[model samples]
Target chain A: MSTRFRPTTLTGHELELREQVRRFVAEEFPAGEYLPGLGINAEASPEFSRKLARQGWLGMVVPAEYGGPGRTAVERFVVVEELLVAGAPISAHWVGDRQTAPALLKFGSEEQKRRFLPAIIGGEAWFCLGMSEPGSGSDLASVRTSAVRTDGGWVLNGQKIWTSGAHYADFVVTLCRTAPLDGVKHAGLSQLIVDLRSPGIEVRPIMMLNGFHHFNEVFFTDVFVPDEMVLGAVGDGWHQVTSELAYERSGPDRFLTSFPLLRIFLALRARRAVGAEAEHRIGRLVARYWVLRQMSLSVARSLDAGEVPAVEAALVKDMGTTFEQQVVDVVRELADAEQRPGGDLFDRLLAEATITTPTFTLRGGTNEVLRQVAAKSLLRGAGRAA
Target chain B: MSEEIELLEQTLDALFARHCGPAERTAAAQGLLPERLWARLVETGLTDLGAPDSGAGLPELVAVAMAVGRAAAPVPLAEASGLASWLLGATGLDPADGLLGCATTHPDDDLRLVGGEPAAPVVRGVLTRVPWGAAAGHVVALARSDRGPVVVLLPAATQVERGANLADEPRDTLRYADVTAVAAAPAPVDAAAVLRRGALLRAAATAGAAGRVLELALAYAGAREQFGRPIATFQAVQHHLVVMAEEVAAVDLAVRVAALAGPDTEALAVAAAKVAAGTAAAEVTRRGHQVFGAIGATIEHPLHHYSKRLWSWQDEFGTDRQWSGVIGRAAVGAGADALWPTVSAPLDPAPEAALR
Candidate 1:
C-alpha cells in the first residue's frame, strides 16, 4: 500500500537458523518420506514437535524470561518458512507456537504467561483458535459465542466450526461476547483460553476434500474457563485480536506450502535440463516469490524493531495468498498431474495443492478483509500527513 | 549517489506533471506538442545536459532522460535528443542549434552505403523503430562496417520513403544516395550495446506508464460498482488487480535496477524490464477494460492513451519475447549461484531506493 520497498536479505542469524531447519527437515522428513497420494499427517506428531523444541526453534520469538530462545521475529519467520517448505507436520503446534505464544507474551498476565508459555516453548503444549462460528466467516465481530460471568469465572456457550487442530490441541483460545450490549456488537467482547479437555467440550473432526482432518467443529456448551486465562482486559478483544492478526497473516508459511511440489517439478524437468517454457514459468514464479519474500521480511523487521506493521502485514497476506495460488496453478499446469491420475507423487502433490489453493485466500482473513485493512491504514497514514 | 541526481529526478517529474500529465497527453493525441514546449524544455538546459562534460557536457543527462521516459511524453526526447546529445559530445558535434534524431540499422548489411549516387539508392532497411520519428528533426542511421558500426547523423530531409506502423508512430526508409559526409572521428560503438541503453530507458518509461495504469485500474475497481457492489469486492477482479500490481512492481524494480547496471548488461535487464512492463501493460489494460466494461476501450476514455503508448513503446525498442530470450540467455549463461548476484547486485548499492 505504501509503495515503499524494503530490502530482502537474510541476516546471519536467520541464515544460520535456516540451515539448522533445513538439516532437520532433510533428516527427519526428507522428500522420500513425502508420499504423494497420502494426505499430510493430520496431527503434528508430538515427538517431532519435541524434536523442534530440542533445536530451540519451537518458540524462537518468545522472550527468554518466558523460557524461549528470545530470538527475533525474523528468526521465527525463517524457522516457520523452512518447516512449511519441507511439509513438516506442524499443524499441531503451528497456531499455539506462532500466534498464541506471542500474543500471550505481549498481553497475558504474568501468572498466565508463566503457566502456559514455558510448556509452549518446550513444544509440550499445543493450542487452537476458536474465533469463527457457524455464521461468522471472516467477520470477527459477528461471532455469536457468548461467555456469561459465572461462579468460578465465565461460562462459554457456542459452536465454532473450521477450527484447525482443535481435536489435538490442549487448549482453545476463543473470542466471546461478555456483555450483550445492543447496537454495539464489537464492544463487551473478550478472549478466553479454554482447556480442550474441559467438561462440555466437543471436538468433531471434519475431513476435507483431500481426506485430511485439518479442521474441526468445536462446541462449547457451558464450558467454564478461569478468569486468569483471559488474554487481555475485558472488552479489549478487538484490539488484541487485530494486533495478533499481523503475526498470523505475514510469514513465509502462508505461501511456501507448495514449494515442495515446485521442487519436484524442477527435479523432474531437470532431467531434461528445463526447456525454455518451463524455465520461463519457473523464473516468473521465483521472481514473484522473491518480491513477496522481501515484503514479508520487511514486516518481520518492522516487528523486530517494535513497530506495528499492521497494514504491511495485510499487504503481505493479500499478495502472498495470490502467489501461493499462482504457484499451485503453475505446478498443476507444469506437472499436468490430475487429481485422480495414475498413482504418482506428482499427481498426489497436485491433488493436494489444488484442493488446498482455495483456502489460501480464505485463510488468514480473506483477501477482501486484508484490502479493507490496507485501505483504512492508507487513509489513516494520509490523514496524518494531511 | 548524489543529491543532484535526486533533484534532477524531482525536477523532471515536476516538468512532466506540468507538461505531460493526462490532459496534455490527450491534447497531443492528434499530433506532437507545439514547438514552445520543446523550446521550454531545451531552455531548462536538459537538451544539452547529456553532451560530454568536456564540451558543454551532459553525462548526467541519462538520469534526466530516465525521468522524461518515466513521464511517457510523446517525444523522442530520450532517443533523438538524449542519444543525440550524448553522441554529439562523444563525436564532437554541437546539437544546441536544433534537434537531432539518432537511429541505427541491424549488424547485417541490408542497407549498403556504397557509390556516392545511384538511380534508386533507396535505403530499404529498418532500424529498431525510434519513438518520435514522426516529429524528429534528423535521423541518424548506423550500419555495421569492417571497422565497426558507425552512426551517420542523416538529416530527416534526406529520407527517400516512409510509412505507418501498428503503434501509430511514423517510421520511414531513409534513402542514403551518396550524400557527402565528413568522417566522424573514432570507430562506431557496439551498436547493440548502445541500443540496449536506449531500450533500458524505454523500459523505465514503460514501467512508469504501467505503474500509472495499474494504479488507475485499481482505484476504479475499488470505487466503481457492478452488480450492486464495488468490483473490488469480487475475488476474481481482486486477484486480477493484484497480479497487475505485481507485474508493475516487477517492471518498476527491474527498470530501475537495469538503469544502474551499466551499458553491457543493461540490455538484458532492460529486456527483462520491457517484457515485464509490456506484458503488464496488456494485462492491466484488458483488465481495466473488463472492470470498466465498454466505456474503458472507447476513444473518449483516457485508458486507451495509456494502452496505445504501452503498445508503441513495447514494439519501439523490442518485443517482449525478444527481450525475454535475451534475459533468459543471460540468466542461463550466468549460471545459478552467480545469477542471483548478477541480477540483484545493482539493487544492493541503492540503499535509499531499497528502503523507499
Candidate 2:
C-alpha cells in the first residue's frame, strides 16, 4: 500500500557520477596505497581527505553558497559507496563530511555555517562526535556531561569515550546537559561544538584490540564553548543528535567496511576451480550485498527528497552491519589464508577484518538499539493503522 | 502508479473480495473449479494480459501477479497470464483462449522433445510439477529438442496424474508418449532465460504474499492481547513484526528492480531477487506464524493460505540454493575486477520493449 518500499532506478546523471567516482578511486587508491579492513576511523589520511576535498567529493550535500558541491543525496551516495568499496582512506574527513556538515546545514546559524562549512568542505576542519560519554554509550539521553552557563560561554565538564578521531579532530560537537533533569531525561540536553584545542580539554588515545589508536577518551575540565558555537537551539540536542545518527547509520560505510576483503576473497576463489558449494556460498553473499546496496540507495534517495526516514535508515544499518559481519565470517571460511600478523596481503586483510568484525554492529549505534528503533517505528505504524 | 493502474488494482481487489473468499478458496483447493469466477476473470481480459507475443511490460504483469498472490487465488493466474502467455508470445504463437500453464525443468529432468524436427516437435517422457496442468486447456513448456531448447504447446487432454503443492493448487505430472504439439517454435531465448522469467514471476508473487503476511501479522499483533495488553506492545513481538516488515520491503524492492533491469543484467537481477524473496518468504512466514501463535498454524485460519503459497512458490521455479548458485557462478565467472562493473551496468528499459 505504501510506496515507500518501491525500488529506485538510477538516473543517467547518477550513473555517470558513479563511473566518475569509480574512476577517481581507481586512480587515487592504486593498489597497496591503503590496507583494507582498518575500519573507517583507523584508515585516516589527511592528504587523501584533502584530495577528495579538491575534487569536491566531501560536503557533497552542502549548498554551494557554503563552498560545497550542492549535490543530491543519491549523488553523494555514489561517491561514498565507491570510496567505501575500494576501502579508501576516508577517516580524516568522514565524520565532518558525513553528518556534521549536514547537521550544520540543517540547524546551524548563518554565522556558524559560514565559519565551519568552508573549512569542513576544504578538509581543514575535522569533526568527531561527542554523544557517547563514559556511561552513556547506547543510552545517550542519560549523559551526565554538564555545560554550566557562564558569562559569555558555557563551562563544559564531561568525559566522552569512544570518540573516534577526536585526537585529530578540530572540533567535537559535545552533547551536554545545560539544565538539571526535570520530568523528562531527554529534555535540557544541548549540543555545543567544543574546540578540541581549547584549554582544559584533554584527549587520551584508546587503543583498539588490534592496537589501533583510532578512538579517544576525551575529558573536559571546565573547558569553555562560546555561545556562538551552540548547534541548533538550546535543549534541542536530543533531536539534533538523533537526526545526525540517521545520517551516520544509513551510509555506505555501514556495509562496505569489509567489502575489500570480500573482493579479495572473491578474487582468490576466481583463480581456482571453486566447488559448487563454495560458489553458492559466495553468490549468496554477493546477492545479499547487492540487495542491501539497493535498499541503502533507496534511503539515500528518500533523504535527498527531504524525507526523514529514520526507521528505514535504521533498517539499513541493522541489516547492513549484520551483512558486513557475515562477509568477514564467510570470507574466512572461503579463503584458507591464515590471519597472521605481517603475513601476505590476503592474510593481513583477513586478520584486520576479523578483528574489526566485532565493531561493525557495535559502532554507530548497536544493532540491538537500531532494531528497537525499527520495531518501535513499526509498532507506531500499526497503532496508526488500528 | 498511473490512474489506470490504480483503478485496475481497485477493480481486481473488488473482484477477489466478491468471489475469492475463504469458502470459495477452500472449495477451489478441493479440486472444484469456480467456473463463474473463472469466466468473470476471463471476461475482465485479465487472462489476455500476458498473451503470446503481446509484448507486455513486466511491471503490468507484476501488478496482476501480486494481486493474484495477495488474494491467494486458487487459479493459475501467474502460470497462465504471466509465464505461459509470455512463453507462447515468445515462440510467435497465438495466445491460448483459456487457462494455460508452463513447465521448465532442471537440465537433468527426464522430460524431452524427441522427434518430428523443429517445426513439428513431439514431447516425450513425463513433465513433473506442471502448474495447473490438470485444470488448464493448454500448456506451454520449455523442453530440449534435437537442435536446442524449443517451446511446445501441449493439449491438457493428454494423460495426467493430478497433484497439488503446499497451497493445494494443482501441480499435476503429465505423462506424454510422443505427444504431438499443437504448435511448436524455436525459442528466442534459452531454457535458462525462460527459467529466469518464471523465477521473476515467482519472486513477484512471493513479494506479494510476503506483504500480505506482514499486514496480517501486524493486524493480529495489534488485536491479540497477552499479559493484559496487546501483543503489539510487547517488544519481542514488535521485533518479529519489524523483521517481517524489513524482509517484505527488501523482497518488494528486489522484484521491482529486477523487473526493470536490462536483458544483459536481467538474469543476475532475477536471480538475486529470487534468492532475496525465497529467503525472506521463509523468515516472514515463520514470524507470521509466531505472531499469530496457534491460530495461524490451524487450517481454519486464512494465514496459511498465504504462508503455504509463499513456501510453495519459493521452491517452485527455483529454491534459494538454485538461484543463488546462478548468481554466484556469474559473479565468480566475472571475477573480482569486473564485479562492480557487472553490477552497475545501466539497465535497459524492459525486456518486452526490446522484444517488440
Candidate 3:
C-alpha cells in the first residue's frame, strides 16, 4: 500500500520457463481437443504429473539437492498460470506441489524432506490436507482432533471432513492437538504426517453436489503417527499453518479456476461477429483476469523476496476468488452461444463451474472469513483508534 | 526511488491535505472554486509537470494527480498536466503553450484544422465536456483535416458553455465557429494517445478517490457504535470494508503500475487501467455508500464528493462499455490462443536510469 512494485520486467529465466511450460502443455494437452477441466479440480493423472516432472516443472521450488528443481516463486508462478488457464490435469500434485512441498521445505525434518521431496517432485507421491473437520471448519484452532502419546508414536483419533482426494492420497498432513490445552487455544497444536494406509482408518466419500467424489470424510481411530512424521516442532503447528495461509490464498489457482471457462467463452465468441454486448462481456472478463493475475504475481514476487505479505495475500485471495467466481456467473449466462463447444464443451464446463464455483470461496478459507482478516489488517494499517 | 521523488510525494500530499478539508468541500458544494487551493498549487510550480527537465517524471505527476483526485479538490484542469504535456510533446509544440485543457474524447465532426494567416491556424467546431476548460489558458483539441488527425492549441479566451459535473467540478464545453490556434501540428499527431492518456489519468484519479472513500468507511466503521459495540465488530460491516479495500488496492495497483510502465501507456496498460478503475470504482462507491448508510445519502457529507466525481470521471474518456468493446474486440482480433499472451505481456525492464 505504501509503495508500488519495483518497476521491472520478468527475468529471462522466468520468460524461458514460461515458454517451456507452454510448449510442454501444447504437446500434452492440445487446445480445444481434450476436455479441459476446471482449474485444479481437473483430472488426477499421475502420468501427466510425471510428464510435467520430466520437464522439471513439478515441485518447482524444491532444491536440486533434494532431487527437485529449485526455482523461484515467480518462475513457479509463470509456469502454474499457463498450465492453469490451459486446464491441465494437475490434481495429482496440485496440493503437494503447491502446499506440501513448501511446508516440507520449511518445517520438515531432513529425513522427511529426503524421503518425500524426491517422490513429490518426481510425481510419484500424493498427499491431502487434513485441516478441515466436521467439528472445525473456519475456526481451525478449535479442532478437537487429539494425538495421545503412545509408545514410539502418537495415537491419532479424529475425523477430518472435506478432505479432497484422501482416498487416493498416499498420506495426509494431519493437524492434531498434541498437548493438554494451556489457556492459549493455538498452543498444544502440532502437525503430523499420517500415512493413509494405516489400520483403523476409514475414508468415506463425501460426494460433491455434482456427484463427484473429490471430497471425503476420513476417520482415524488410534492411527499411529511416528515421532519422525511430525512436521516442525510440537506446539508449532499454529505458526507453520498460519505461515502458509498466505501461499495458499494468493496463487494463480485462486484467480485462475474459472480462467479456462473465460478462455472457452472467448474462443466460442471470438471469430463470430459477436455483438457489442458480447464483446463488452469478453472485455470485462479479460481485463479482470489481467489485473488479478498481476495482483497474484505480485504476491509471488514478494514471496520470492522472502517477505510474507499476509495482508496482500489475503487481499489477493479475497479479490481473486471473487473475480474468478464472477467469471462463472458471466459465462453461465452465455451457455446458449450462437457457437459453443464440440457438441457441448462450453455447456459441460459451464455446468461443472456452476456447481464448483461455490467451493472457490469455501475451500481456501471462506471469503467471509477472509474479509474479516483483511479488514482487521487494513484497519490496523490505517491506525484506526476507537 | 530518489529522495527528491519521495519529497515531491510528501509535498504534494501535504499541499492537498492542508486545504481540501471541510471548508473547501463546503465551498465546492456551493459551486465555488477552490481558489486558494489552486493558487497554492500553481505557486509550487508543480502544476506543469510536463515541463522539460522539471526534475519530476510520470511517477511524480501520477502521484500528484492521484492526490488531487483523493482530495476531491474543486480545482480546474491543469492539476495533472500529463495529457497536456503529452500533446505538446507529440505535436512538437512549444512548451510555452500554458495550461492546456485537453478536448480529445468529444466528437471532432465539426472541428477542423485549416490554413489561416500562417501566423495562426484556423480551428472550428465544438468540444463538449472538456474538463474545466474555462480555467485553462489554452485548450488543446483533436481536430480533423485533409491530411489526418490534427491537434491544435487554441487560446481559451472565448466564451464556453460553463458546465458542472455531478460533483460540481467545472467541465466547460468549447464551441467555436472559427478560432485561431496559436500552435498547430498535423497528421503525425496521435489522437488515440491523447484519449488513452485521458483515460489513464481519470483511472488514476478514480483510484485515488475510491481509496479516500475506503479510508472514510474504515474510520467510520471503527468508530460508530451499534448494538453496544463499534459497527466494525459486525461481520456484515467488515465485509463491506474489506471489499472496498480490495477494490481500492486493485485500482491503486492498476493505475500506478500502468503509469510507471510509461511509454506504453498508449497500449493495453492504459485501457486495462481504465477498465479496472471503472469496475472497481463501481464496487467501491456502492459499498462505501452502504457502509455510510443514511448519512452518506445527504449532500453535506464529504462522501458524496468522492462518489460523484468517481461516477462522473468513470463516464469520461470512455466508459466500461466503450473501452471494454475496444479491448474485447482487440482480444477477438488476436484470437483466443493469443489472448493470455497479450494479457500477460510484461513490463519493460527498469534499468537504474529509469528508476526515478
Best by lDDT: 2
Q: In candidate 3, how many Å is residue B166 off?
A: 0.8
How well does candidate 3 score on lDDT at residue A211?
A: 77
Residue A19, candidate 3: how far off, in angstroms?
0.8
* lDDT score of residue A36 within candidate 2: 58
Best-fitting candidate, scored by DockQ: 3
Write one digit per residue (lDDT tens) for candidate 1, span A261-285: 6655554434322567655666555
Quote the lDDT for A210 in model 1: 65
Q: What is the C-alpha RMSD of each candidate to the true structure, in Å?
A: 5.7, 2.7, 2.7
| Best-first order by TM-score | 2, 3, 1
**Of the pair 2 and 3, which is ahead by lDDT?**
2
Superposed by TM-score, candidate 2 places the C-alpha of residue B147 at a distance from the truth, in angstroms, of 4.2
Candidate 2 at residue A304, lDDT? 74
Model 2 segments beyond 4 Å from truth? A1-3, A32-34, A38-41, A269-273, A336-338, B1-3, B52-55, B106-122, B349-356
CAPRI quality of model 3: medium
